[model samples]
Target: MKLHAGSNILLNLLVAVAVSLVVNFSYLLLLLVDQKNDPAPPPPPEEVLRKAERLQCGALHVSPDGHGYLLYSGGDSIYVPMQRIRRLGLRDGDSLVAEVSVTHVPLAHPVMGKVLRRNGAEFDYGSLFKRPAESVVLTLQLIYYVLISFILLSILTPVRFRYSRRRFIVRCVWCLVAAAGLYFVALVTEWRTGRLVFNFMTPRMLDYVLLLKCSFAVVVSMLYGWVYVLIMQQQAVAMENEQLKNEYLTTRYNMLVGQINPHFFFNSLNSLSMLVREKHHDKALTYIDQLSYTFRYIIQNGQNTLIPLGEELDFIQAYGYLFKIRYADKLFFDVDVPEEFRTWLLPALSLQPLVGNAVKHNAITTVRPLHIAIRVRDGYLEVANPKAPKLETEPSTGIGLENLRSRVHLITGREIVVVDTDTEFIVRVPLQNPAL
Candidate 1:
């Protein structure tokens, strides 16, 4: 089943908790069996008993045989008779405080103590670590479980996501082999260090139990690893989809920009024909020179996704020259970008389209001249033109502005800002440092 990110986190936590419970349950079973086979040490040494007896009503545990009990105080356990069980009724598995006394007694009835109060389970964790070597071994076992779990989650999980079905199966098999190898190493270490000795089970039975525990841990690790792998796979698929969408948008924008070139060439040729018919030979020569320069710039850089702002400006100036010759004193173009920001990056041919759009949609005559200005402000390149909407003109395809906006968004993840008013129209393209 597919799970959300939150559910994945919850599942991971649950797995950890389950692993802990399993380990603790196995240890508890081992502890019970060990206690059953070995009798409690005969009433601690005399000096130890004396020290224990001086302490006030401390913890007590009922004997497994139910014939007697052990009273624990000051880090010592003193055997006590059942008769001394006083104000609080005695029972197996009940923790309580009792007054204890040291004395020589018969084997049939050794303890001599009085029960004072029942205090439920003593919760004395220190008692579990009474033997220094056993405590160290237990600590090492805990560390081993934690380390194995972490490696399975952090390392194997990613590997599963990165491989195919056949490879993943092979990886899983290898992981199991590694886990078994590590378990064997741990067993050898414990055995060599004399930490595997158990009073309850025979050595064969002990080996079988250890094997069972290790097998359970390995299985749990694999299960949790699969869940993590599933999560990683889902995230990877999502990222891939996003990248594909961005590529589609970029291609669409480029196609739209490509359409502008044909229409621009047709308009420039019409202007050139007019100049030739009017017998303006010198003006026609200048127009041809400017047109060639502009076309060369476009041809050289049109395929590039981005170019330096200064280069784009140079292309725009050459393009503006063609329009100036066509309209004479009726059209004007001004550029005021800062020198420091000239090296900033921008989409190629981004500004020329805006200039062409202004001339196409607005009437340019001596009675009412058209003015276009390009400048930089507030980390954006501003292209502002005075509005003079044509009453009778072909409807706009809107491809120019849309293409510019899409390219800007795809490249920088930022939108181009447009502001239109009755008197003026402005487009703001965000500037980006080339070094970044």
Candidate 2:
């Protein structure tokens, strides 16, 4: 329920107004009743009793002619209208007390002003009725309710830079707490425009009108909070799902690009032919075995997310053999990794791209042999080789190294660092400690 700008303001404002209207529904009904039944001077008091607006008490008596009277107020009866008797459901024996006014009419009796009580219990006029339901008074009430609701929603719904589980829990707790507090405040003050201190302690605890207004306030506030939390949680989950879908897609793409594509397949065969031409049968047999193992390793491990460093290095040994046999003394692998780092895991085939890039981009010769070092340094698997740029070389697309970098990050949430200087090209890939 985070509020955004423009259209969101109008939507939230409407939500606030709706909550206010519902919460004050009973009070609004009372307003409408008052507007329809505005009490008029009751048939000119039959006998002027006292000044207007004085309290009068007597027994209620309604006649068949649609007229009613409160008998025995200071030995004189007061005129009560039939509509008031019907609204209050008054009976002949019922004791009633109300404000009375004197009107200049002969023998009509003093007219009732406002009903204050029936029997022993007090009546809440504020709850039962309010005048001017559709007048400027009602408009003021509407404005008051709208303001309260708008502010409440503006505070309740907040914009957050990022979603957080802990913060969400805290906010929900606060919402219920605020609702509980607002319940008491609403009881003490009027929810509508009658009065802020309207009818306090007038209605008994189980009064239906009182219960309706209070319950609506509490329940609607609680419901608003519940709906807000539900929407926010759902949005967060949807965003997370979308992000994972993209990551899954990227990982699949990297795996496809990682497959060995016969880059050195024909080169190995040419080296093997030279060995057989020189009549070195044993060496050629060993070369075929190593070449077979390299291809098998690539195909088998391509689907895997991660493998032990030792397992990857074993495959590299088979892979490096073909290159070593081709270069002979011009290229050499200086392996210096310890056995302790062998169990650490990294992405499968992570090192192959680095090795391929070293050979593809640099020139190796008898004058300055390509001494590629594979070692563990500061928790990283470091592969370093002295730069020997060929005088005339094709431009490198750098796709292989970029592919490895993306794969490693996708699997381990880590980055691969590459430093290419005048003398050496160093690539350091992070290693994850295997879970015990």
Candidate 3:
């Protein structure tokens, strides 16, 4: 099973306690052997024993009635019972206070002189609970753990910043080499002074290798967990950005395709009504055909990001026919696109919106003629029309122009510009770079 932060900390603490206990036990055993023949030293000083803080170090073993724990400090053992508190009343990792007192005895007897001579009496468990040093010990352990974590994260996480498969393998080898160096250092110190450091291994290469392997396993597991979490965060951010872009593109496409104004449709129908009343049946049929072609091109281009300039101009010509039918002799529409410019790619529906904006905002009548012009000039496409006053009942919303500007900006690094020259309303759009 995988170890969580709490479980890992608990395991580390247990291992430390076990190692300390073994070292203390071995020291006592050696003392007993020395005193087996020689007379025993006096018991540890009363002042030193009394001054020793009683540190309760063990897991809280809860009981049915309330709570209780097996408390051990030095050679003393006792039980602490809390019969009044309920399960919900306590929290995990909580500690209690305790004070302890004991009397030690020395032995001249063989093995007992070194080992058993240091034995002490078991003090009252209640007195110890009243002032236990568990909190201090736990606090110190917490600081130790935080410091170790900070050091490891600072060093290894940065290493991962420079990490790759090759680097990881190299680092693993370096850790083994450093562990070998440390093992040799420990062995030399022990051989001279006859004391072990951390009891990592016996005096052999095989034992040192096993100890290094275990430590490296623990460190690498931690590194992998951290790295996995960072990778997941980065992937999530990238996915979210992709989703946002797709949504924006979909919305813009739908807006451009579906947004032919109702005003334009109604006005064209009115003009068709006038044409029929005048008995121009042939012209009426031609106007209907042009209208159909205009709407068809719009629908077809909805699914495409870009279309040939030639195709767009053909659609614009059909749309101009509908305008001619509406304005009769009062409006003139002209196109001057060069043959070389015909193959240039432009965003679909780019021209229609600009023409539609002019039709919607300006007035046209037999008495007041409106001349609209389109041409490709000097690396730009210019659409210009005479500025006529708005008819009193004309729809005044300028959303079509605004939508065109935004779409142009998205498709190319250019914006459609409008210039009013006393009598003309001119819009200039730079030729979109095909490379873009």
Candidate 4:
């Protein structure tokens, strides 16, 4: 029922950083208005040609009074306004190539007009101001949007108790609100002119950059919301599938414990009954002990998923003794397992089916004794026995072996390797590596 990863600090941080990288903020210029502070636009060609007659090229001189004058080679100079000087941060001894116009003042030099070039570089009045570089602007913008995104995510997390259309719509609306709020930010930080100046008289027009940022914000919100929901939903599905598989395994294990093979039970009973009738008192009591142990082991372990390899081996030894009594000197088992690997885990009752299959299909006699070997190799528990064909082969649906294989797959997500040859048959069951 867990829904949202909003509490995941790492995921939230990553989303904020990604949004910052994707969002573009430099386009704020086209969204908000700014004061008409930059120099006027260039005149038409005919007006420029007429103005060129009075255009002069000279070195700039700043007087003590903060006024500017362009000094030519012939010592002639023209007056430059103080306001323009302050705006462009004009200094003394600059190469000022400028245009001029006459004034109606008494004996005043012609007033300096728009600057054509400064130090051989053409610059508009706004461009003359030392504005921040594009990278610098982008970086500041990234930081700003990163903070915004984090705050938004914290307030209306993508996933909370559960997904709701109202909540999703609210998140979308919040993104738009955040985006619209950028207009105020642009008002303060004029893109083309002064940055962070807080001028309200600036003019704004249709800008693709502002449109782009708004669109990106809304889209990011939608995408993040859906992705988070999808991830949570997927995890929920996996958990349900695991639960269903466990239920199926439970049913199978119940059958394993509740239903013993009818033929084997009757045969064991007949053998015990015969021993009792023959007055083999000690043998009969020992057979009953072994039979009880075998049933107890199966019932105890049937519902379990896995047990230590050593424990199953103990169970197997007891189980094998039951058959040894029935076919004395005709069936033998050689179990060779290292102590270090005894603690490794295997599916419960895994060996039961394999042992049953071998005994069922194979012939056992005083001459051709069936030898079942249990050993561990390469992190696998291998049970191998020589193929002994009986005079009459037993009818088998193979459901026992197939069920064991399916159970292993369900519990451990692994497959059992079965090898069948003319001379021998082997089943290799993978074990869980033991912990230190």
Please state every model's RMSD to the true fold in angstroms: 12.6, 13.5, 21.8, 8.4
Instruction: Record all residue pairs in model 2 with backbone atoms less than 3 Å apart, i.e. clashing.
Output: 45-108, 45-109, 46-107, 46-108, 46-109, 47-109
Model 3 C-alpha lDDT per residue in residues 24-112, reported as the tens digit of each score:
34444655576577865543434443554443333334566654543344543434435322312333333333333223546321110
Off by over 4 Å in 3: 1-206, 261-264, 365-368, 390-395
User: 121-155 in candidate 4: lDDT tens per residue?
Assistant: 67566456656655566667777667766656554
Q: Candidate 2: worst 10 consecutive residues by lDDT?
A: 42-51
| lDDT agreement with native, every candidate | 0.70, 0.72, 0.57, 0.75
lDDT of 2 at 242: 88
Off by over 4 Å in 4: 1-138, 149-167, 190-195, 198-212, 220-292, 299-311, 324-346, 353-402, 408-436
**lDDT measured at residue 128 in model 4 versus the true structure, 0 to 100:** 62
Which of the numbered candidates is closest to the native, going by highest lDDT? 4
Q: After superposition, how far is residue 317 of candidate 1 from its true place, in Å?
A: 1.2
Q: In candidate 2, how many Å is residue 345 off?
A: 2.1
Better of 1 and 2 by TM-score: 1
Q: Taking the tens digit of each residue's C-alpha lDDT, what string does model 1 give over 122-171?
A: 32323332334544655666666655554444445543246456755766
What's the residue-level lDDT of 26 in candidate 4? 34
